[model samples]
Target: MTSALPTRRFGGFLFDMDGTILSSIASAERAWTDWATRQGLDVDAFLPTIHGVQSVETIRRLNLPGIDPVAEAHALTEAEMLDVDDVVPIGGAAEFLAALPADRWAIVTSAPRRLAEVRLKAAGLPLPGVFVTAEDAERSKPAPDGFLLGAKRLGIAPEDCLAFEDAPAGIAAAEAAGMTVVVITETHGHAMDTAHATVTDYRDLAVEWDGASLKLDHRI
Candidate 1:
C-alpha cells in the first residue's frame, strides 16, 4: 500500500517557467546549439550551461574575444522567439496553474520578457499578472533577485512563498530568497540531487484556497 502524500500551505506561489511549468528544452536547445556552433564552441559542453541562466550570463561566461554578451543575448532571444513550434506545456501544468488564485502566484524566469511571453503563448499557457523576468532583476538565478522581485510583486514575504523549480540555478535562487522549493523532475533524465521535495509533474498535486491562504497537497 502507498503511504499518504504530504500537504503544505503558503501565502504565495512562485514558478520557474521553462522546465517547471513547460518544457522548452527542444526549442531552447535547438537555438543554443546553433549559437554554439556559430561561435565555434563544443555544442555538448556549452548546451548544459545554458539551462536555468540568462542568455547574457551564458554568453558572458564564455569570455570570447570581441563578443558583446548583451547584444548577442538579444539576438539569441530574437531567434528563440521565432522557434516556438516545438514548445509545449508540461503535463498537468495548465490545470495546476488554473487552480491557483491569480493574485497569489507569479512567474519568475531567467528569460527576458519577450522571449518568455512568446514561449508561454506557444505553449498555450496564460500570461501571468505578476511576472518577474531577467530585465527586472540586477542578477540572475542563484542570486535570488528575480524570485525576491516576484514575491514583492505578489505582496508576499519571501519566506511565505513556496517556489516551484526544475533546475539547480532556479532552486538555489528560491532558497536564497528564503522560500521552500519543490523540484519538478519531469524533463530530467537523471535523478536530481536536492533535499527539497520533488515531483515528476503536477498530475498528482492539487491546490485549494478558501478565502485565506493557498493549500497544496499530493493527491496520491
Candidate 2:
C-alpha cells in the first residue's frame, strides 16, 4: 500500500508575497511606472528588474542622482497600497495555507511591511503569523538576510524551512539561507536547477499538520 501523506516534515514555510502567494503584479507595475515616469527614467528598462528585489534597492540600482531614495521608497509604498484592486491570491494558495498550522508558515517579501499587509488584505489572504518585509532586513532578495531573518523569527532553524519563490532572486535568497526551495511558476517560466521542486500553481501542492509538525506534498 502507498502512503497517503508525505513523510518529510519541515519546521516552517517561508513564502514570497507578490508572486508566490498573492498576485500583485498589476499594482506593483502601476506604482513603479508612475515612479519611473516622475523620475524621468526608463520605465521599460527598470520594470523588468524590480520584480523580486526591494524597492529601495531598485531605487539605488537606478542611480537617480537627485531623488531621495528613502523618501522615494516611501512614496512608492503609499502608491502601492492605494491601488490594490487587481491583487488576488494565486490558484489554491488560500486553501493550501489554510491547511497548515499558522505558526509553521510566514511571508518573506521584498515589499515594505505596510505595502505587504495592504496587498494581502486586498487579495483576501490572511495576514501571516510572522511577516518579513524589506524594512525588516538590511538586504533583500538575492541576499540571504531576509530569508534567514524570517526563519530566525519563526523560531525555526534555517535548514529546516522550506521556501516558496517565483523569481530567480528569491530562489537564490532561500538557497543562500540554507533552505530548500519550491519554485512556483506564477512568474518565472522554466524551473531553475537550484530549486528542490517546481509547481505551476498551489493546486499541485498540499500541506498537512502531521500531529507534531507540518509537511508538504506535491504531485511532481
Candidate 3:
C-alpha cells in the first residue's frame, strides 16, 4: 500500500534542504518574484530557471544585462528573510530523517548557514550530523564541492553515500561526487533525467540502519 521504489544500502546519506526536506519553493518564489518586481525585472521569465541555485549563482545565470548582481543578491536575501515563515517540512520529512541513524546522514545545501538553519528549524526537522552550506564551498551545486565536503566531514567515501535532492543542480553535485542520488519530484518539475531514482516524496519511502549496514526499506 505504499509508493516505494527499489531500495539500496549505502554508507551515508546526503540531503538537500530547501525543496528536498522542506517545502519552501513557494516562499523562495515569492521572495524572488517580489525582488524581481521591485528591481523592474521579469519574475515570470527568471524565477523558474533560478530555483535550486545559490543566490549569487542565480543572479549570474539570469544574465540581467546591466543590473548590479551584488545588489540583486542582497535584495533576494532580504526578501527570503522577510518570508521565512512560508517554509514547511515536506510530508514525512521529520519522520524520515529521525528514522535514520544520526551518524549516517548529513545535509549538503547551497543555502548559506543562516538561511539553512531558518528553513530547517521552521520545518521542525532534525539538524544533520554534518551540514555543508554555501559558505563551506567556493563552488556550489553542479560542482560537487558541497557534496565532497559533506562526505569528507562524515568520514565516508563519496561512492558510499546516497543523496536526496529536489533539483538537477544537487543531483549533478552528488553524481559528480560519485554518490547515488534520489530525486524528489514535488518541488522541481520532472524535467531532469539524471537521478539514480525518482520518488514523489519522503512519505513514500522507508529507512533502516543496523549499525554496520544501512538498509532502505522500499515498502514504505
Candidate 4:
C-alpha cells in the first residue's frame, strides 16, 4: 500500500534535516511548547504550521507583542540544544548517507546553523560536506532559496539533484528548486502526494555511488 522511490541516477542529493533524516519532533515540540507558553501562545495551535520552516517564520506568524523574531529564534534554538531528548536518526538515514561520497550530498535545513549542528551531533549523524541552514536564506521553505543555495554550493545543478523531505513545505521548496522529491512519511503520514514518491523511512530506500553519480532505488 506504499509508493515507490525513484530509481534514477542523480548528480547529487539534498536532504532536509528534521523529520526526514533525523527524528527530532519530540525535542522540537517540547522546546516550542515551552516557548509558546512563555509568549502566552497556545502550544497546540502554534506548533502545527512551524515544521519544515525556520523558527523565525513561526515566531512571525505568532506575532507576539513587540517580540523580535530573531531573538525568539535564538531562544528556541537554545532550548532545543538544551533539551536533547528523544532525538535520533531516522531509520537507514545513517546507512544511506554513508553509502554516498562526501561531495554527492548536502543538507538543506530549516534550522539555524547552530541548532542544526546540535541536533545532528546529538542524533549521531555526520554533518554534510555542504550544509545550508536557515541563516543562508531570508526566505525559508516553500521558497526555493535554501535548496537552490545548497545545490549551488555543492556545485551541482539544481535540476540534476534529488531531494528527500518529510513535510509539504520541504517538498514544495525542492520542487521549486527544480529538483525531484521523495517524501519520507514518518511525520507527514503519507499525505504528501505531490512528491515523486513516498516512503516511510530511509529504510525503504537504498543508495549507490559510482564516483561519478548516485543512484537511489527502492528496497521493496
TM-score of candidate 3 to 2 decimals: 0.90
lDDT of 4 by residue, 31-134 (tens): 88887788887778788887998988878877678999998888889888888768999888998888888988999999989889988999899999999998
- CA lDDT of every candidate: 0.90, 0.83, 0.80, 0.86
Give per-residue CA lDDT, model 3, range 177-200, as digits (tens).
988777777675545565267776
- Supply every candidate's count of residue pairs whose N, Cα or C atoms clash at under 3 angstroms: 0, 0, 0, 0
Q: lDDT tens digits, residues 18-38, model 1?
A: 999999999889989998999
RMSD of candidate 4 to the truth, in angstroms, is 1.7
The 10 consecutive residues of candidate 1 with the worst lDDT sum are 1-10
TM-score of each: 0.96, 0.90, 0.90, 0.93
lDDT: the better of candidates 1 and 3: 1
User: lDDT score, residue 135, model 1?
Assistant: 90
The CA lDDT at 128 in model 2 is: 89
**How does model 4 score by TM-score?**
0.93
Number of the top-ranking candidate, with TM-score as the measure: 1
Those runs of model 4 whose alpha carbons end farther than 4 Å from true positions after fitting are 1-3
Give each prediction's root-mean-square deviation over alpha carbons. 2.1, 3.6, 2.5, 1.7
Task: Give the range where candidate 2 is weakest over 10 consecutive residues by summed lDDT.
Answer: 1-10
